[model samples]
Target: MPDTQLTVTLSGEGVGDARVVVRALEQAFGAPDELPSDEKATVHMATFTGEARAEGSPTAPGHLSAPVAVTVQGAPGAVRRASETLARAFTTRDEGAASGDQEQERQLLLEP
Candidate 1:
């Protein structure tokens, strides 16, 4: 099977909040290609390349200070897995989603 790749774009909060979300994603998708940098911008992005964890030790979800808007784009299964991972880590409000022949995208609002 092709490697599942997930691209996550985050905004609304700062790097600290972004890290929290990234950490949650790491639990399922493993480490991202790179860590979230301190770019002093409103948005941060990371890409994870691997399969989602179906069996592993569960960890406590991290806390968020303010709401974070997350946009995930990837293969259909990868998008769904990442969205589910974020939802499990924080309270998420479904914004909307789109689908193509081979890829899917979803937007979610995560709150403390």
Candidate 2:
């Protein structure tokens, strides 16, 4: 089991209702902390808030905005890399990218 926590910004049109948002988050996290989703992995998570962002010039009639945010959690050490482990998930450059130990050697558990 992995408890990897990470954060990234999501941009989309009409993110939808709270229920839909929670469902989306559960899908994103790959599991449910306090709800149900389609993911098979259990990565407990919670989103505090997602404030709408205003886009475009002030004079423009049509503008769009997406909520930017910070997420926190823990994941596999091999799959996560850095000089130091994250101190309570804050933010990441992006998701599904090799963010740790890009060149570390792999050894069998029973080797040593």
Query: Evaluated with TM-score, which candidate comes out highest?
Result: 1
TM-score of 2: 0.24
| TM-scores, each model vs. reference | 0.91, 0.24
Poorest 10 consecutive residues of model 1 by lDDT? 52-61
Candidate 1 per-residue lDDT, tens place, 1-112, comes to 4456989999977998898898998888888888788859799999998666664665765789999999999999888888888877789999999999999999999999
Across 4-109, the per-residue lDDT of candidate 2 in tens digits comes to 3433222223333222333433323433344423244223234322222222222211222333222332343322321122211222233323324322221111
| Candidate 2 colliding pairs | 3-74, 4-74, 4-75, 5-73, 5-74, 72-89, 81-100
Record all residue pairs in model 1 with backbone atoms less than 3 Å apart, i.e. clashing.
none
lDDT of 1: 0.87
Candidate 2 regions exceeding 4 Å error are: 2-21, 28-31, 35-66, 76-112
Which candidate number maximizes lDDT?
1
